[model samples]
Target: MTGNLTTIGFDADDTLWHNERFFRVTQDRFAELLQDHTPVELDRTALDHKLLAAEKRNLGRYGYGVKGFTLSMVETAIEVTDQQVPASVIQELIVAGQMMLSYPIELLPHAQKAVEQLAASHRVVLVTKGDLLDQERKLAQSGLGDLFDAVEIVSEKTPETYHEIFTRHGEGPERAMMVGNSMRSDVVPLITAGGWGTYVPHGLVWEVEYAEAPKDSPRYNAIEDLGQLPALITRIEDGL
Candidate 1:
């Protein structure tokens, strides 16, 4: 009942530290910057839709992180303004992206303790997707970086990705477990890879990261936060 897991993987953004909230704040700033450029009253809903569409369209080209999001914002601005958006607005958007890159990493409640506790018994790895430099900077600032046995900054998280990472870092997917906030990136694919996928919800989630819960999967789990992770792990190991 106590040794089912050999490796514990964690998601970086929103899982270990504050991430999406800062993006939300920057999005509001994005809307404000575009207000003067638009010919008519700007609809927040419509703008958000355009921005989301742009993000989806640009994912392949830009990948993920502040740099990509900033580019999407610029594209949306130009589209909404009929290619008449000011150069000054573009400068402000670039500056905003810079600010996001430099934002201080704020660890979520119980994140450090949970990782530290699990690391004592299992190989703990940071498996997150984002820009390489940005992710590295965040990890360096998080203070929890030293606790992890390994770190992986990937372009995406898929079943194959989980399988490879788990096998490389620990025994394999069967003896591994992943804890994170995104049902899509951090949970579902991990479950598909034959590992325990634990969902720890963070209130602010990116739209693209949203996915329906896999309630029927025996390996799927949901916890309110990382604070509850250790107990949940104990329950799973006990075969409850």
Candidate 2:
């Protein structure tokens, strides 16, 4: 089974197109708006903690998207300030969240070439999670749409998603590998499902799910970017 792979799943957002930079910009704006109520030292951290807590709490009812983020920010603000935070601040977050305009919408530096090479030798699947319409529009605009054998825009990534994905593509767990930027969204679940995964680091990952996983963990490997994907895959399979 070594060095022989039939299928690969990729994550979209920060892994393919530019995603978190928009959120960073909006967050900067958000901090500026709330400066009057929260202290200078508490400006960013307080708001961030509040929002993350709120989002996780409401994750089930709302799901992850601009609307959830916006509502979370508003509720977080009110929670911290103990007053109705200005509607104007929430509106700014809302505008930033539209997300149609959030991403730069260009494929990462070598995403096209890496995908091209992998597809020539193995099956390629784009498994991204986000607001469905915006995610689809991004792929359509990316011009890399036809390259993938299957494109999965999921609400969440769990062992079940991986099982369904591999079964649908007729690819076995041992024969498939998932690639992406987020550990929680991509690597953790795949490993849990007895599948392999390669993590390509992004400049800005979402804050909530950021952490370091032990290198000794099987089914986990890292690459600098998609440019190194082809070799990286072989390197991981070699059990390096």
Candidate 3:
């Protein structure tokens, strides 16, 4: 809502461009890469869950981005294969990460229009968490770089991070709003920090990023897509 929102922060990955799709595709490839080692009857769903577990365990060490995810996939391969995983498989996993890092940046439906429209009324900033170099590359390739008042590639999206971002870029949390796909990283923390939190759930969610929605919170709202953002902001400004 624009009532007290002078700055609106957006999450860059799945929330803006096609991100999680690449990861999902790569994960499928990962499953196939390790399929030979596991029993034929080993459930694919269980394997996927194991990979997710590895990723979550390594989040602190590798942080969030393709590199961290790639490492986790490699670790999972080794674990699933009982430390006998082949050199070629690890090589392929590295190649998969390379492919993801270089993958084309395809903006989500109405991402550009929504960003441009919102920028007209509010200070729109890109507040995404990930590997700095890869995130910078995506932003540059997205061609929507100039649309943002600022671009912040953060290590994590905690209350302290959001607070610092708002304080440095504009007013504090009361004058800010965060729009993203992650309930844990994007919405909950900002809302906890006294800012508006708008959840825009994507079809393919990273399991590690999932958290129960704070639906009962008055400051939180979940929208279907970015296309709805402009009108939502307008409604808030209109006090409707």
Q: After superposition, how far is residue 5 of candidate 3 from its true place, in Å?
A: 1.3
Highest lDDT among the candidates is held by which one? Answer: 1
Which pairs clash inside model 3? none
Cα lDDT, all candidates: 0.92, 0.78, 0.90
Each candidate structure's TM-score, on Cα atoms with residue i matched to residue i, is 0.98, 0.88, 0.95
Model 1, global lDDT: 0.92
lDDT string, candidate 3, 106-130, tens digits:
9999899999998988899999988
Worst 10 residues of 1 by lDDT: 35-44
Q: Please give the ranking of all candidate structures by TM-score, highest first, separated by commas.
A: 1, 3, 2
Residue-by-residue lDDT tens digits, candidate 1, 45-80:
989999999999999999999999999999999999
Candidate order by decreasing lDDT: 1, 3, 2
Question: For model 1, which pairs clash?
Answer: none
Residue lDDT tens for model 2, 76-184: 7677767767777767667766643546577789999999988887889999876777777789889899999999988888978997897688466667888989888
